[model samples]
Target: MNETIETLLNHRSIRKFTDKKLTDEQIHTIIKAAQQASTSSYMMAYTIIGITDPDKKAALAEVSGHPHVTQNGHLLIFCADLKRPVAQATSEQYEATRANLENSEHFLVAAIDAALAAQNAAIAAESMGLGMCYLGSIRNNLARTDEILELPKHVIPLFGMAIGTPDHQPELKPRLPISAVYAENEYPAYEEDVAAFDQELADYYESRSTNNRKDTWSEQMIRRFAKPMRMDVTELVQKKGFNKR
Candidate 1:
């Protein structure tokens, strides 16, 4: 594998971090890489909020239900931002309407753009020997987060990422076999492949150095699906003035 591929394959979420600070140059270079990620139609519908205030970090940690949110050397919240382009278009006498901004397709596009940029940032940080973890649990209280961040209309906080010097190097989590995820021309039946992966994951969980368990991937997923999660997200999104259509 090439250096980039090797960096991608060795990805791990680093929860524990040392007290090392990221230099301004390092932050600039990493964000530059994120800005270089592909965006649909070049809309670049994303905004990143770097949380530096102790009060804000503490509030975010409480909202995310993860104390580690405040422990990172740098915490960035990636937001799906349609406000900027829409406002600019309106200012330029373009037909920018609430309906256009609230379209489900636009919402999806913004979300995808934010995710792509965050992944690019993640890879860049990893390549630089910095440890990072994506904090999706920030969605646990989207409304509260919106309030805390004082997000304006047409903007949604998709996720947060915490980056720092690694104090703990975790083992890479196992993934499904390629056959289960990849398809040639036509999509093939993947249940058998998933069944095989369930066994492999079960073994990995049982033998892992930390948080060892006897659960399989399928079992965990089943438990996760048993109850609906984030039921208020749709309403919250609508309140943010997006996905109305």
Candidate 2:
């Protein structure tokens, strides 16, 4: 097997990080790698905010509910920014110009661009022997995050990443079985696939229960989606001027 494939297969999130601060060169290199990621239409409809301020980082930590957002040696925020395009269109609303605000294509472009950039940065950081964790909670505090970052209209936080040297090793996370995900030239067939997957997930959880964590896959999913969304992020994003269009 290829070394890169092996490394990717062994991928796991690292929460515990060393106190060592990364140098400027390392930071620049990682950012460079992120810039090299595939972008949509070369619009580069994404923004990455590097936080070095303690207060900002601490505030972000509060937003994420992940303490490491502040404690980690480095923190970066990935943003799906449609603000620039909106501004350009508004400013240059000439006879031949003016983009449709309700265009869903632009929103998709920003989101996909941000995701690609994030994956590039994650892989790059790992190659440098650095530990990193992605924070999906950036959306949990959407309006507050926009205020904190001073984001203009049509911009939204996609996620955040905390990077540092590894201090402790975490157990590998189990992925869904191929039968659960892979479909041969067509959409997945249900019932049999789902039942087989549920069992595999249950077994994986059982194995992890030895660490004093119940680790039930179904329980986790239930807890995540059972409750009403406190943030109502879709509405919030609409309020932010994307309008999900």
Candidate 3:
């Protein structure tokens, strides 16, 4: 396999990181790579907030409930931003543009843009031999996170990333089989495939090097979605001037 394919296949979410920090050059390179990611209609509607202060990082860590937020060599918060475009609009166009920006479609675009850029950043960090973990728990309390970051309207902090040198190597987690994920003409039923994957994932959870647990992928999904999760997201997103349409 090619080096790039190998890198993609060997991906693992690294949680534990060494004290060795990323150099300024490395940080710049990673952000540049992220900026190069494809954007919808040339609208690079996102902003990256690099947290360097100890107090800010600590506050973010509290919001995420993950100590790694403070312990990582570097922390980056990726935000979906529409405020920049809105700011540049002409006085005549401002009202119409603001109305368009409030649409749910634009919000989705910003979110997708942020996610694409984040994946690019992740690949860049891994290719440079650095370990990184995505901090989705930052969204667990978006209101507090927004307050901590001092974000303005039309900008929302979607997620955070913690990057650094590897302090621990984790086993690669198994994914659902391709048959269950891919289809040619139309979406196909994959009950059998899912059942098989459940067993595979259960085995993986039971045999991993650390934090072994007797659980299946299906169970994990159920546990995650069976109840209303982050129920405050709708209200908070609206507060940020998004999804109003």
Q: What is the lDDT of residue 216 in candidate 1?
A: 82
Q: Name the TM-score of candidate 1.
A: 0.96
Rank the candidate models, highest lDDT first: 3, 1, 2
User: Ranking by TM-score, best first?
Assistant: 3, 1, 2
- Residue pairs of candidate 1 with colliding backbone atoms: none
Q: Global lDDT of each model?
A: 0.90, 0.77, 0.92
Q: Could you estimate the TM-score for every candidate?
A: 0.96, 0.88, 0.97
**lDDT agreement of model 1 with the native:** 0.90
The residue-by-residue lDDT of candidate 2 on 84-160, one tens digit each, is 65454545563222244335677677889998998888888887788898988866777777778888766788789
Residue 223 of model 3 has an lDDT of 96
Q: Which candidate has the top score in lDDT? A: 3
Specify the poorest-scoring 10-residue window by lDDT in model 1: 88-97
RMSD of 3: 1.0
**Which of the two, 2 or 3, has more lDDT?**
3
Superposed Cα deviation of residue 209, candidate 1 (Å): 1.0
Segments in model 3 whose C-alpha atoms lie over 4 Å from true places = none
